[model samples]
Structure formats: C-alpha cells, structure tokens
Target: MFKAFVKIAVLLSLTASMAFGYQAIRLNVSEGTYKERNDAFNGILEVDLEDAGFTPKDIHPKIEYYYKLFYGTKLLKDGKPNPQFKTDYVGNLDNLGFITISNEEWMRELLMKEPKLGSFAPLNYLIYKKKSEDKTYVGTLTPQAMLDIAEIKDAGVRAAFTEKIDALSDATDEGMGGEVEYVEIDKLPAKTLIEWEIPFDRGEDVLDAKFDFMEKFEKAFEAEEYIIAGKRDFAEYWVDNDLENDKYDAYWVYSLCHFTFSYTVFNVWEHPELGASAPCSMYMYLDKDSSTLKVGMPSVDNWAVFGKITDPKRLQFIKDMDSKIKEIMTSLGAKEI
Candidate 1:
C-alpha cells in the first residue's frame, strides 16, 4: 500500500511538472492580534494610488469591497447547517475576513479582452486570528500570479496592473506590519477557462422575456444542486449612479453556491480563508459592437492550486465543479470556445 501510494504521488508530480504556468505570491504577516469584526475595528487605510498620476477611479470609483466572514461565529450560532458544525470548537482561530480590492474599470476592461484574467482580479487579502496564537496573518494573492494565470501578453497593461497592485500591497503590508514572503512553486497546475458563447442580436434583453438564456442558465445549475445566492448588476448600478453610463451595454455577475460543497470545503475542510473566492462568480456581458453575448469564468481549479490543495480527492472535486459549469453553459445554448 505504501509503494502504491508513492507511485501515484510521483505520477501526479510529473503531471504538474508538464503544465506549470503560474505560482502564488503570498504576503504573510505572522505578528498581530485581531478581535472579532476586524473589518469594523481595523479601519481602512487610505492610500494614494493616483498620486503618481494614475486614475483607478475611472473604472469604478468604489475601490475596496470589504466583508467579514465570521466562520467561527456562524458555526457557533447555527449548528444545523452540517454535522461538523456541532463539533466542539477547540481551535485557536476565532475570526477571519476576505478583503477584495480592485479598480473595476481598469480590471474589467482588461478582463473583457481576456476573460481568463478574471481569476485574480478583485484581489483578495485574507485576515485571520488563531485563538491559541496571538499573531494574526494578513496575506494576498500576488499580482504576478494573476498575470501569469491570464497569460497576459501585453507588456504595457501588465506593467500598469502590476504597479497598481504593488501600491496596494505596500499599503497592506505597512498596515499589517508584516514582512513579505512568497510561497511559490516552479510549476503551476492546469487552469481552465469555462467559457461559452451565446448568439444574441439584442444584448439588453438577454436576461429579459425576449430570451431564455437567463432562465436556462439558472435551471441548469439548479438541476446540478447549485443555488443562486444572489446577483449583482453592475450596469444597473452605473446607470442609476450616473457613473460610466456608456461603458457597458449590459453587465452582471452571478453568485453561485452549492450548500453541500460549501459545507465540505468551509466547515469540514476548515479553510474559511478560501472564502476569499466564495460565492463563485461567473460574469456575462455584451459588447456594444458585438451581437454575441460573451460569458465566462475562471476555473475553480485555480483556487485549488493557489490554496495549495494537493489532495487528489479535493482537486477532482474542483475539476468536477468546472465541468459542471461548462455543462450549464452549453445547456444554455452557449458553445464552448
């Protein structure tokens, strides 16, 4: 049994070697203490990304979207979600948060050109404290990794994006008072783009009565045991607020959550920090000049790799999620591109 396990591990290592493309850049501060609701007590530090003449607000003025994931609190209050939730809490970790920061207009336009780049945008900063340990760690997914995952070829855009994120990184490091160190690998596992195209002449009504795209999209996932946690319409917000009125013909992102899957990952796996990618996002939109509605999402496998998930079982589960997403896209008349 030991020999067989070793052989399997060697085979998996070989497979990873052949497909290396990106690695994670992690910034960790291992000294600090965080109380519950860190998002509320830890005030956001204002940094000037544009003092050097860069305008991030041109994309989306609201730069930072902060949210706290009180994983411990949730389990303590509601022991009904899963059997594991009823387990005694003997861990040192008491609080956690996922901070998403991005210049939407800047990142969104780049993502529109290369949908795969969406994997790393809305960059995440993880904050957590262990009950047994006094130190709180604050970390981020490096800009370099995101660029590599997207295979971004534009030197100019890559430079600008990297510079923008570097500024943010500096601010975060300073705020947390943690030295930056990278957790890296020579080879990156395969990351797939689950995207499909839909033929539509009228873009605005794709989600309206004129088409069944939205209905079919939802039904397909529902059939697969996924539920719509919610939806965010960026276009509607822009129009209402009179910000970038003509930027997009239509734009929205759907938040998908599988209760069982989430329970296994968050509660059983005990990796609440992975909630940084929670409510898996899939975005769809129509370009003003194009009749086709482009829909796409970065594969969940990227998260598995970045999260350092080496267990074959867990990796396979992530792949299955990707396959399921592709199936839904196809069911909605979207041809995989």
Candidate 2:
C-alpha cells in the first residue's frame, strides 16, 4: 500500500510539472570603457511574454498608454503584440511593468518583501554596481503570473487625473490684470520705486548694465521706506504705505528700443480684494531682443470667461488698461522704445 501511494504522488507531481513549463529568462549587462562609477546607467530588457501565451493588448489600456508615452512604440509590433491571439493575457502591474511570473511565485522571498507601488511609473530598473565587482539582482512580481488588471487601471486613471489638474493649474493666471487704479493718497507716505531699461551688446554687458541700474535706483529711493529685491538681470523696488499698510511693487523690463523701458505696479493688499488670490503677486514678460514688455493680465476668471473675452465691454476694458499703462510710463520719462 505504501509503495502504491508514493507512486501516485510522483505521478501527480509529474503531471503538474508537464502542465506548466518552467523557463528561466536571462539578462546580460556590460560596463563601457568610459563609464563612470557614479554615473547612472540605463538599458532595455526585452521580455518574451508570448511564450507564456500573453500579448501586449491584454495589458490594461491605461498602462499600455503610459508605457507607450514613456518608451514609445519600440516594443510593440505594429502598435501591439504579435502572434495575433493567445490563451493567456499579459497583465498590467500598475503601469510599472508587466507581470510575467506565475501565482506560485507570488509569496516568494524578494518580491514579497519589496513594496511595488509607486506614484511615478518605473521606466527602468536601476542597478547599482558595487565598487569591488559588478553585481546583478533579479526581482520578480509578487502576485504571480495572474495579476489584478483592475488595480493597475485604477492607478493609471488616478495618475491621468492628477496630470490634468497640474496642467490646468499651470495654465491658470489669477490676478493678472483687473479694474485697478493708481491711488496717490496724501496720507500715505510716498515711496519711490525706480526702474531702468538698459541696452547691452553681449551677455557680460547685460549683467553689468543690470548691476549699474540697481545701484542708481537704490540711491534714488534710499531715503524712503523701500526694499531692493532681485538680481542684476531684473530688479524691483517696493515701497510700503503706512496708512493702509499697502505695498507698491514696481518691476522694470528692458524695452525693444534702446534705452526705452516698461514697468508694472501693484498694491499687493488692495488687489486681493479685487479677487486676485494667486500665490504669485505678479507676472512680467520682456522681449530683450525686441525691446518690448508684454504685460500679461491675470486670468482669474480665465476658465469661466474663456473665448467670451471678445465681448465689447471686456475688450474695451483691456484696451483701456493698456492705454493707461502706456500713459503712466510716458509720465515717468519712459520713451516708447
């Protein structure tokens, strides 16, 4: 009876082994002649999931999209895995990589200990070469050959949503320009902010001109309560008002015409009441080559008023503000350069 039972156990083991073929995938690495020890190294490992009866199309759609976005179409044949059809599917593993291991290996040593989830999808498996000799570590998936495609899809969807939000926020320009006035209140102490437009032929000259302007502006506004901010490339003069504790900030940009200048001003505290709650106080763009300062207005209601800014009232408001700025610059002895 004992001999028969042992024979049956061996037969069952053989049948199971035959049902699932075991194969080892090997990857080779080499060090280049000019390679530095501290420098980062990168390489691609071509995996044959076809042997396991899997194809790229079986991967979660979102993971596939991310993979394409990062690595491009180098791996996919005609934008998809070839061999047409297969019984097994290549499972998405959170857009990190594909799971080619089987379920039996899920609870194995290295994979089980390593935490696999990451916000940024892993593009390459980074390897560190030991100082003494070259070493390679092999890592495997934990959940086995069969994986939860839904989990990977969910992570991909969440990442896509986050990227969309970031793009929206970056495009948003709140408190750029609004219905604002220059109020010279007598009760408030006058603060002087001097800006300069200097022309330079070379890069070094540009730095010198900027430094020279800061020195002169500092002397001109030194008596009043002022703060000198920014480096030589561009600088700002800020004056504080005691009455309402309002601050007047002025930024100067190089104009298209030589020695011509353009500037923008804002009362930091008062503008917030105008619904400008941007983390940045202001934005200024200068075309040094063209000598033009294109002052962009805050698009606080940009999303709400997009494509509708063509309305007569809105157009007039923008034109009026532009005219006012030009007039102010003229009064400050700034010729339109």
For residues 88-196, could you state the per-residue lDDT of candidate 1 as single tens digits?
A: 4233345555444444555555654555454454444566554556765555556666676656777776887777776665555445544454545655556545666
Question: What is the per-residue lDDT of model 2 for residues 132-197, given as tens digits with 9 covering 90 to 100?
Answer: 334321122111111121122344444543343222211111101111111111121121111223
Winning candidate number (lDDT): 1
Compute the lDDT of residue 258 as modeled in candidate 2. Answer: 7
Off by over 4 Å in 2: 1-204, 214-328, 331-337
lDDT of each: 0.56, 0.25
Worst 10 residues of 1 by lDDT: 58-67
TM-score of each: 0.67, 0.19
Q: What RMSD does each model have against the real structure?
A: 10.0, 31.1
TM-score of model 1 vs. true structure? 0.67
Worst 10 residues of 2 by lDDT: 257-266
